[model samples]
Target: MQPGTFELLILIFIFLGLQAWWIIPIINKNNKFNKRGKDLREEIKQLEKLYKK
Candidate 1:
Protein backbone atom coordinates (compact mmCIF):
# COMPACT_ATOMS: atom_id res chain seq x y z
CA MET A 1 0.00 0.00 0.00
CA GLN A 2 3.01 2.24 0.37
CA PRO A 3 4.43 4.26 -2.56
CA GLY A 4 7.11 2.39 -4.63
CA THR A 5 6.43 -0.87 -2.72
CA PHE A 6 4.16 -2.12 -5.45
CA GLU A 7 6.78 -1.36 -8.05
CA LEU A 8 9.32 -3.42 -6.14
CA LEU A 9 6.89 -6.27 -5.88
CA ILE A 10 6.20 -6.04 -9.59
CA LEU A 11 9.90 -6.15 -10.33
CA ILE A 12 10.32 -9.22 -8.16
CA PHE A 13 7.49 -10.93 -9.99
CA ILE A 14 8.98 -10.02 -13.34
CA PHE A 15 12.33 -11.47 -12.32
CA LEU A 16 10.68 -14.66 -11.11
CA GLY A 17 8.69 -14.84 -14.31
CA LEU A 18 11.83 -14.52 -16.40
CA GLN A 19 13.58 -17.16 -14.34
CA ALA A 20 10.65 -19.51 -14.78
CA TRP A 21 10.62 -18.79 -18.51
CA TRP A 22 13.81 -20.76 -18.84
CA ILE A 23 13.65 -22.94 -15.76
CA ILE A 24 10.38 -24.60 -16.66
CA PRO A 25 11.53 -25.54 -20.13
CA ILE A 26 14.81 -26.78 -18.80
CA ILE A 27 13.02 -28.99 -16.29
CA ASN A 28 10.60 -30.26 -18.89
CA LYS A 29 13.38 -31.06 -21.31
CA ASN A 30 15.29 -32.86 -18.61
CA ASN A 31 12.22 -34.88 -17.75
CA LYS A 32 11.69 -35.74 -21.39
CA PHE A 33 15.30 -36.76 -21.75
CA ASN A 34 15.07 -39.00 -18.72
CA LYS A 35 11.85 -40.54 -19.98
CA ARG A 36 13.37 -41.23 -23.37
CA GLY A 37 16.37 -42.81 -21.75
CA LYS A 38 14.13 -45.01 -19.64
CA ASP A 39 12.15 -46.06 -22.69
CA LEU A 40 15.29 -46.94 -24.59
CA ARG A 41 16.48 -49.00 -21.69
CA GLU A 42 13.22 -50.85 -21.58
CA GLU A 43 13.34 -51.52 -25.30
CA ILE A 44 16.86 -52.78 -25.01
CA LYS A 45 15.82 -55.05 -22.19
CA GLN A 46 13.08 -56.47 -24.34
CA LEU A 47 15.57 -57.04 -27.15
CA GLU A 48 18.55 -58.09 -25.10
CA LYS A 49 18.64 -61.50 -26.71
CA LEU A 50 18.94 -59.94 -30.13
CA TYR A 51 21.98 -57.95 -29.14
CA LYS A 52 23.74 -61.10 -27.97
CA LYS A 53 23.39 -62.65 -31.40
Candidate 2:
Protein backbone atom coordinates (compact mmCIF):
# COMPACT_ATOMS: atom_id res chain seq x y z
CA MET A 1 0.00 0.00 0.00
CA GLN A 2 1.18 3.52 -0.85
CA PRO A 3 1.60 6.00 1.96
CA GLY A 4 -0.30 9.29 1.87
CA THR A 5 1.55 12.62 2.03
CA PHE A 6 0.67 13.16 5.68
CA GLU A 7 1.86 9.68 6.57
CA LEU A 8 5.14 10.32 4.74
CA LEU A 9 5.69 13.55 6.64
CA ILE A 10 5.03 11.86 9.96
CA LEU A 11 7.47 9.11 9.09
CA ILE A 12 10.11 11.66 8.19
CA PHE A 13 9.69 13.48 11.50
CA ILE A 14 9.92 10.26 13.46
CA PHE A 15 13.10 9.30 11.64
CA LEU A 16 14.63 12.71 12.28
CA GLY A 17 13.71 12.58 15.96
CA LEU A 18 15.29 9.16 16.36
CA GLN A 19 18.46 10.34 14.66
CA ALA A 20 18.69 13.36 16.95
CA TRP A 21 18.09 11.28 20.07
CA TRP A 22 21.01 9.04 19.16
CA ILE A 23 23.28 11.90 18.11
CA ILE A 24 22.70 14.36 20.97
CA PRO A 25 24.19 12.14 23.67
CA ILE A 26 27.31 11.48 21.60
CA ILE A 27 27.80 15.22 21.07
CA ASN A 28 27.40 15.86 24.80
CA LYS A 29 29.91 13.13 25.65
CA ASN A 30 32.46 14.55 23.21
CA ASN A 31 32.10 18.00 24.74
CA LYS A 32 32.68 16.61 28.23
CA PHE A 33 35.74 14.70 27.04
CA ASN A 34 37.16 17.85 25.44
CA LYS A 35 36.67 19.84 28.64
CA ARG A 36 38.39 17.16 30.74
CA GLY A 37 41.34 17.04 28.34
CA LYS A 38 41.82 20.81 28.67
CA ASP A 39 41.72 20.56 32.44
CA LEU A 40 44.31 17.79 32.47
CA ARG A 41 46.63 19.81 30.23
CA GLU A 42 46.48 22.76 32.59
CA GLU A 43 47.28 20.53 35.56
CA ILE A 44 50.25 19.05 33.73
CA LYS A 45 51.58 22.50 32.90
CA GLN A 46 51.41 23.48 36.57
CA LEU A 47 53.23 20.30 37.57
CA GLU A 48 55.98 20.93 35.05
CA LYS A 49 56.52 24.45 36.45
CA LEU A 50 56.84 23.04 39.96
CA TYR A 51 59.43 20.50 38.79
CA LYS A 52 61.49 23.32 37.22
CA LYS A 53 61.82 25.08 40.62
Candidate 3:
Protein backbone atom coordinates (compact mmCIF):
# COMPACT_ATOMS: atom_id res chain seq x y z
CA MET A 1 0.00 0.00 0.00
CA GLN A 2 0.97 3.64 -0.37
CA PRO A 3 1.21 6.40 2.21
CA GLY A 4 -1.85 8.48 3.08
CA THR A 5 -2.52 12.13 3.89
CA PHE A 6 -1.86 11.81 7.58
CA GLU A 7 1.54 10.20 7.05
CA LEU A 8 2.44 12.90 4.55
CA LEU A 9 1.51 15.61 7.01
CA ILE A 10 3.44 13.96 9.79
CA LEU A 11 6.51 13.71 7.65
CA ILE A 12 6.25 17.35 6.68
CA PHE A 13 5.81 18.41 10.28
CA ILE A 14 8.90 16.47 11.35
CA PHE A 15 10.97 17.91 8.53
CA LEU A 16 9.96 21.46 9.39
CA GLY A 17 10.54 20.84 13.07
CA LEU A 18 14.06 19.64 12.43
CA GLN A 19 14.76 22.57 10.15
CA ALA A 20 13.50 25.03 12.71
CA TRP A 21 15.43 23.38 15.51
CA TRP A 22 18.67 23.90 13.64
CA ILE A 23 17.83 27.31 12.18
CA ILE A 24 16.17 29.08 15.09
CA PRO A 25 19.28 29.08 17.25
CA ILE A 26 21.40 30.53 14.46
CA ILE A 27 18.78 33.17 13.86
CA ASN A 28 18.64 33.99 17.56
CA LYS A 29 22.40 34.24 17.81
CA ASN A 30 22.52 36.59 14.85
CA ASN A 31 19.81 38.71 16.40
CA LYS A 32 21.73 38.93 19.63
CA PHE A 33 24.87 39.98 17.78
CA ASN A 34 22.90 42.59 15.84
CA LYS A 35 21.47 44.01 19.05
CA ARG A 36 24.90 44.19 20.62
CA GLY A 37 26.29 45.96 17.57
CA LYS A 38 23.41 48.41 17.66
CA ASP A 39 23.99 49.08 21.33
CA LEU A 40 27.69 49.73 20.71
CA ARG A 41 26.86 52.16 17.92
CA GLU A 42 24.48 54.02 20.18
CA GLU A 43 27.12 54.25 22.88
CA ILE A 44 29.61 55.62 20.39
CA LYS A 45 27.11 58.19 19.25
CA GLN A 46 26.49 59.26 22.84
CA LEU A 47 30.22 59.58 23.46
CA GLU A 48 30.60 61.71 20.34
CA LYS A 49 27.80 63.98 21.53
CA LEU A 50 29.45 64.37 24.90
CA TYR A 51 32.87 65.05 23.40
CA LYS A 52 31.52 67.75 21.10
CA LYS A 53 29.78 69.54 23.95
Candidate 4:
Protein backbone atom coordinates (compact mmCIF):
# COMPACT_ATOMS: atom_id res chain seq x y z
CA MET A 1 0.00 0.00 0.00
CA GLN A 2 2.91 2.31 0.65
CA PRO A 3 4.20 4.06 -2.49
CA GLY A 4 7.88 3.36 -1.77
CA THR A 5 7.24 -0.31 -1.12
CA PHE A 6 5.22 -0.61 -4.31
CA GLU A 7 8.03 1.00 -6.27
CA LEU A 8 10.51 -1.41 -4.75
CA LEU A 9 8.33 -4.34 -5.66
CA ILE A 10 8.07 -3.12 -9.24
CA LEU A 11 11.85 -2.76 -9.43
CA ILE A 12 12.33 -6.25 -8.13
CA PHE A 13 9.94 -7.65 -10.71
CA ILE A 14 11.70 -5.79 -13.47
CA PHE A 15 15.08 -7.08 -12.31
CA LEU A 16 13.90 -10.63 -12.08
CA GLY A 17 12.25 -10.37 -15.50
CA LEU A 18 15.47 -9.15 -17.03
CA GLN A 19 17.48 -11.84 -15.32
CA ALA A 20 15.10 -14.50 -16.56
CA TRP A 21 15.32 -13.16 -20.09
CA TRP A 22 19.08 -13.59 -19.98
CA ILE A 23 19.10 -16.86 -18.11
CA ILE A 24 16.40 -18.81 -19.92
CA PRO A 25 18.28 -19.12 -23.21
CA ILE A 26 21.38 -20.35 -21.44
CA ILE A 27 19.32 -22.91 -19.56
CA ASN A 28 17.66 -24.04 -22.77
CA LYS A 29 21.03 -24.48 -24.45
CA ASN A 30 22.27 -26.51 -21.52
CA ASN A 31 19.15 -28.63 -21.67
CA LYS A 32 19.85 -29.43 -25.29
CA PHE A 33 23.34 -30.55 -24.40
CA ASN A 34 22.02 -32.60 -21.48
CA LYS A 35 19.60 -34.35 -23.81
CA ARG A 36 22.38 -35.13 -26.24
CA GLY A 37 24.46 -36.48 -23.39
CA LYS A 38 21.65 -38.73 -22.33
CA ASP A 39 21.23 -40.03 -25.85
CA LEU A 40 24.92 -40.72 -26.11
CA ARG A 41 24.86 -42.58 -22.84
CA GLU A 42 21.99 -44.71 -24.05
CA GLU A 43 23.88 -45.48 -27.23
CA ILE A 44 26.91 -46.46 -25.24
CA LYS A 45 24.88 -48.78 -23.08
CA GLN A 46 23.41 -50.44 -26.11
CA LEU A 47 26.82 -50.86 -27.62
CA GLU A 48 28.07 -52.46 -24.45
CA LYS A 49 25.16 -54.82 -24.37
CA LEU A 50 25.80 -55.86 -27.94
CA TYR A 51 29.44 -56.46 -27.22
CA LYS A 52 28.67 -58.56 -24.16
CA LYS A 53 26.26 -60.71 -26.10
Per-residue accuracy of model 2 over 1-53 as CA lDDT, tens digit each: 56598899899999999999999999999999999999999999999999999
User: Candidates 1 and 2: which is better by lDDT?
Assistant: 2
Worst 10 contiguous positions by lDDT, candidate 4: 1-10
Q: Write the per-residue lDDT of candidate 3 for residues 1-42, one digit (tens) a residue.
A: 465988998999999999999999999999999999999999
What lDDT does the true structure give each of the candidates? 0.96, 0.97, 0.97, 0.98
What are the RMSD figures for all models against the true structure? 2.0, 2.8, 2.4, 1.8
Q: What TM-score fits each model?
A: 0.81, 0.88, 0.77, 0.71
The clash count of every prediction, one per candidate, is 0, 0, 0, 0
Show the colliding residue pairs in model 3.
none
Residue 37 miss distance in model 4 (angstroms)? 0.4
The candidate 1 region of ten consecutive residues with least summed lDDT is: 44-53
Q: In candidate 1, how many Å is residue 19 off?
A: 0.4
TM-score of 4: 0.71
Tens digit of per-residue lDDT, candidate 4, span 1-53: 76699889989999999999999999999999999999999999999999999
Residue lDDT tens for model 1, 8-40? 999999999999999999999999999999999
Q: Candidate 4: lDDT of 39?
A: 100
Candidate 1: misplaced stretches above 4 Å?
49-53
Assess candidate 3 and give its lDDT: 0.97
